[model samples]
Each structure stands twice: as structure tokens, then as C-alpha cells.
Target: MPVENSRIKGLYKQTVQERLKLVAKAAGLTDEHVQALSNHGELDDVAADRMIENVIGTMSLPVGVATNFVIDGKHYLVPFCLEESSVVAAASNMAKRCLGHGGFTTNNDEPVMIGQIQLLDVEDFEQATTNILQAKHELITFCNDVPSRMIALGGGCKDLEVRRLNTHMGSMLVVHLLVDCRDAMGANAVNTMAERVASRLEALTGG
Candidate 1:
């Protein structure tokens, strides 16, 4: 069956159980989904511990909905789990006010990031900078050569940058690898590239 309408009248005025039943019926949710939603302690200590380093208990937050949001011409009831008061109310108010204009529109850009490699204790900063700049293509190729699913998906190292800095301890060189991460956050990929190119960078900088 197709969903004809999502605008439920006075859904916020209903009781918790009443609201759940209405939402479940409208969304064609199963009994298991409703049960899971109603249950409090869904995450046990073992699961929580595996998720994070601490072996302590889990914290709880109240879940509320901000209604009347129409993004890209589709209605959405956003769920927010927050401790601050009036946030849900404020969001709902703003969304309701904006409904007359066409709700919200969003644009996304291709994800790109820089991986920084810091080379300390450089004997000659000028020579080290020149050496790294001269080997820019090689360094960028080394980064792109790393085995990554992102590279296969049309994303990898784009360019290399060299910066020389003078500090209280000594002079150092910082190498930046510009990368296109595609859809991922790129932290792991960037860090891996930085670690793989560190020895070559050290040799170039004589640090």
C-alpha cells in the first residue's frame, strides 16, 4: 500500500501509547518495532562497554518530535533526544513558520580533507622544504597507492603541500596531503596515509 498522507491531526495532544499506536498504524510498523520502542533498557552493560572504553552504566534522554518540517517537498517528523528544554518546541515552531515558503532546501558538497604530517628536529628547514616540494608528485602518489575502498570509488589523494615552521624547540616541516574522501569522514584513511608516508617524509626532511 502507498502512503496517502502523513499529516496527522492533533498527534501531539494524544497520550504516549495513543501516539505510538497511531504512528505505527500510519507507518505500517510491526509489533516487534513497537515493543522495542516501548522498552526502556534496550542496551545492556555488555553492549555499552563494547561500544566505548568505560564499563559504567548508560545514560538516558527524553525523546521528542519536532513536527511540520517539509524538506524537498516531503514531510518529516524529526525526532530529537536532548536534555535542553524548549528545543523541540522551538524547532517545531520554526518549521511550522517556514512551511508557507516551501520548508527547507539543502545542498551538499564533495567531501575533501587534508592529512597533516609533522616532521620535527629538521637540521635544515630550507633544504627540507625544497626537497619535499620537489618530491610532491611522489608523496601524493605514495598516498594514493595505499589500499582503500574509497580510491576504488573515485576518491583518493589529490595534492601535496609543504609548510615550514620555526618553534622554540627547533625548526620543523609540516606536509599536508589533500584528499577527496568521497562519502566517508576520511579520518582513518587520512591517518593511514600520514603514517605510511612518515618515513619518506623523515628521510626528505632529515629529521
Candidate 2:
């Protein structure tokens, strides 16, 4: 009710700096606040240009703040740094409407990626393919044996596939390994596993 009361009383109608001042006052920083305001008010283009990239001069734009956000059941004051008009107002209105039903829910899947290793220079492509197929279990075990700490955290090589490709370089068999990385971005892990598997596969084929 306190939040609703603050909204109804126009306390939420103030700008961000004004609200910050109110917060500082509530936190008993009223006496030192004048110095803070004076310091901020003295900011000029020379310092801003040094801090920002390609800031030749000051650009005039209307700054607005949006309120009433509920993302994943948590309330938030969404800030939009833009010069575009009506975007913030529209987004805020939509967020308010969605809050009546329920807040927005976001979900992310486990990061999994596939890497391909192309093997060439083999005497018998068919036999090489068969050899890799038979060694599939060992390959998987080898991947798990290295005990990739990243893979251990909800990540590991899961499946393997063989592909036959006919390029100008001649026919080659490409091996694809699918890795599941629980919470990580997984790019580096997938790439490392792919390289390791490729080396082992080359050795198996006596390449």
C-alpha cells in the first residue's frame, strides 16, 4: 500500500534526479546534498567529450523515464536511454497491462552446440567411417575422461554423427559431436572438444 500511496501522491511523478534527492534526504544526507547538486550542475562538455566516444559537442534530446514494470514476478524501474519519442510511454503502458494478469516469464535452454571435424587423406573412406563408428563409445568416454570442468557443470559431449562429403579435395568423412553445456556460453568448450576429437580421429585413421 505504501508504494501505491506514493504513486497516488505524485511522488513517483518526479524525475530520476528528484527521486534520488528524496532518497538522499530520507537517508539523512540533506545537509551535504547541496554540495552534490552544485557538483553535478557544474558538469560541462569538455569533461563529457573526454569520457564519451566521438562526443564533438552536446546533443539536445528529450529524456524520459518509464515506470511500473514486473519482469519474472519482480518489480523494476525500467530505464530507457533513447531520443525516440513515445517508445517509453508505450512500453510502460504495455507493462502495466501485463501486470494485471501476471508478470512476464523468461526461460533459457541449456547451451548445446555441435562441432564438425572433416577427415581426409584416408585410403578407404568407408573403412575409416566404420572405424570411427566403432570407436564412438571410446570417443565419448575420452571426452568425458578429460573431465572438462565446464562440461562437468551440466555440460558434456552427448552424441556423435558421421557425414560423407564429396568436395574438390575428394571424398571425406566429417564427424559431428554435440555437446551440452549446462549454464555456460559453451563456444570455447565445444571448439576444444571438436579439436580433441578431430586429433584422435586422425590418429585412429593413421592420418
lDDT of candidates 1 onward, in order: 0.73, 0.61
lDDT of 1 by residue, 1-207 (tens): 122344556765665566667666766768886776555366553443334221112345445556677787777766665556667667877888898899889888768899998898888888998998899889888888967899999999988888877788876788888889999999999999999999999988888
TM-score, prediction 2: 0.56
Q: Which stretches of candidate 1 lie over 4 Å from their true place?
A: 1-7, 25-28, 40-61, 82-85, 118-134, 147-154, 163-174, 202-207
Instruction: Locate the minimum summed-lDDT window of 10 residues in model 2.
Output: 1-10
Superposition error at 97 for model 2 (Å): 7.2
Give each model a TM-score: 0.66, 0.56
Per-residue CA lDDT of candidate 2, range 1-207, in tens? 012211112434554456445434433445455344324333443453233221212223223334456666666544453445567667767777787877578898656778888887777777887898899999987876676777567568988988788888788888889888777777887888888777899987755
Off by over 4 Å in 2: 1-12, 17-90, 93-107
RMSD of each: 7.9, 7.8
lDDT (Cα, 0-100) at 139 in candidate 2? 98
In candidate 2, the residue pairs with backbone N, CA or C atoms under 3 Å apart (3 or more residues apart, or in different chains) clash, namely 151-155
